[model samples]
Target: MSLRIDNQTCYFDTDTLHERLPANTVTVITDSDKPMSAVEVAGQRIHITEAQAGALTVAGATAGRRYLRATDGDSVI
Candidate 1:
């Protein structure tokens, strides 16, 4: 998968299900057969998906953090 969790030791997929992200937060909308799920952030857990996993190139930012607008065609897995 191109999308992956940004971690030092552990990693996972990064998918964007929506065009806009919630305030001070991100979302993971997925549909995968694999049991893999959720992302780790600031000791908290965010959702992750297999179907949404892929390399995403940021086209622009709407809220504040980098938003995935297009795929850079780079995968972590």
Candidate 2:
């Protein structure tokens, strides 16, 4: 998986699932921080399976905050 940050938005791309599965859980980790509410995937309350050909957008991230880690369940990629 790859993570890209733009302002307060985070874009996550992965190639693990061939089909759209149910929404998974997303955790955005920053320096010494737990998952925050502002971070989300596709604007969903939960992490939904991204389209096979598209990337997942995690919006509402804290401004000026640098994200060092992100995960979907046990699969980081």
Per-model lDDT: 0.32, 0.37
> What's the distance in Å from true for residue 10, model 2?
0.4
lDDT for 50 (candidate 2): 29
TM-score of 1: 0.23
lDDT of 1 by residue, 1-77 (tens): 23332321223323532122321243332223333444334444444443333321121111222333333568543
Error of 2 at 46 (Å): 12
* Candidate 1: residue 58 Cα off by (Å): 11
Name the regions of candidate 2 deviating beyond 4 angstroms: 16-77
Tell me each candidate's TM-score: 0.23, 0.25
